[model samples]
Target: TMAGTGAGYDLSTTTFSPDGRVFQIEYAMKAVDNSGTCLGLVCKDGVLVAVEKFLLSKMLVEKTNKRIFPVSRHAGMASAGLVTDARQIVQRARDEARVHTENFGEKIAPHVLAERTAGFVHLFTLYGSVRPFGS
Candidate 1:
């Protein structure tokens, strides 16, 4: 799971079971300091997630709302912090996966995709702190 803060702040929590089940909950504030909250729940395949807003609106109230975005049919994202940065990262991953599928055909295994994603994230995290703004 990825998380962090921008525009608004979020307090998020998650739980996982030994049987490969997951549960995530988040509380988001409206402004950087407001007191409202929204809730979200997602269950896909064997993964589950839940989010609760604290001070923020449950749904997008502006055209610029970028907190929650769908990455694929089987994947969606919610940001508790650093919403824009996280969304960009997720979007890039989705785009890369799409490009890979277009080039390599759709027969790739889920494990392969997951491994690639892990490698990408690892590389980013490793070099991010040393690089300028982690291009």
Candidate 2:
């Protein structure tokens, strides 16, 4: 059976609208779309990341904001959404890498780190008490 098409469906993260859209996820995407540009490229030697910062306020100090953050010795992330939210994600990623190294006696692989970070972000959308990151 098809679910009802109503605005109420958007209020719950676990509920999908009649068209199969998750409103919370959509909201997060909108936030990212409105933020600074972030991109990455793979070169012959390594990867390169760049972020175009958007200054929205006059009181903000110039050249003080950092959009790229290191998670491990060899891994880092370039973010485009809210700064505080990005910081939380970076911190969680660092912790994940640290814990993986402690338990396995090696650095966390890039794919493993990505999967762990994605799972961590996904959890926020499952509960009503917390909106999805950057949403």
Candidate 3:
């Protein structure tokens, strides 16, 4: 039913198709889904995170690629998608936490930091000049 109708709209995230689908975001989700597996569990002392990444080459060494990145002393991020995009987001999160600490004289709370990071990521969807984040 919805065949060629998605062609023109899929060009930009700011464009919504007839069925109200943002094709760019849908495609980005697909990319993330194929990246790898990441899991987190709440432990007695703190949360534990694990990542399973597929290496593109047999020559590559294990544990050379990083998937979990530290956002702050109390917060971290596990990303599944493009490494560059994940790094960019993580760097932005670090900047946000640093700014919050500098302004408030206290570390940024996890919820507040999440909200700020989400807000920053949402901007890409609102502008035609930017593509949706791969992660």
Q: What is candidate 1's lDDT per residue for 12-58, written digit by digit as tens?
A: 12333344322121221222123223345445646544444443455
Lowest summed-lDDT stretch of 10 residues in model 1?
Answer: 5-14
Under the 3 Å rule for N, CA and C atoms, how many clashes does model 2 have? Answer: 0
**In candidate 3, where is summed lDDT lowest over 10 consecutive residues?**
1-10
Off by over 4 Å in 1: 1-48, 56-66, 107-110, 128-135
Each model's TM-score? 0.44, 0.84, 0.88
What is the C-alpha lDDT profile of model 2 across 70-104, one tens digit per residue? 89898999998888889999999999999999999
TM for candidate 2 is 0.84
* TM-score of candidate 3 versus the correct structure, residues matched by position: 0.88
Report lDDT per candidate: 0.45, 0.85, 0.88
- In every candidate, how many clashes are there? 18, 0, 0
Rank by lDDT, descending? 3, 2, 1
lDDT of 3: 0.88
Candidate 2: stretches off by over 4 Å: 1-10, 16-21
How much is the lDDT of residue 28 in candidate 2? 74
**Candidate 1, 19: how far from true, in Å?**
37
Worst 10 residues of 2 by lDDT: 1-10
Candidate order (TM-score): 3, 2, 1
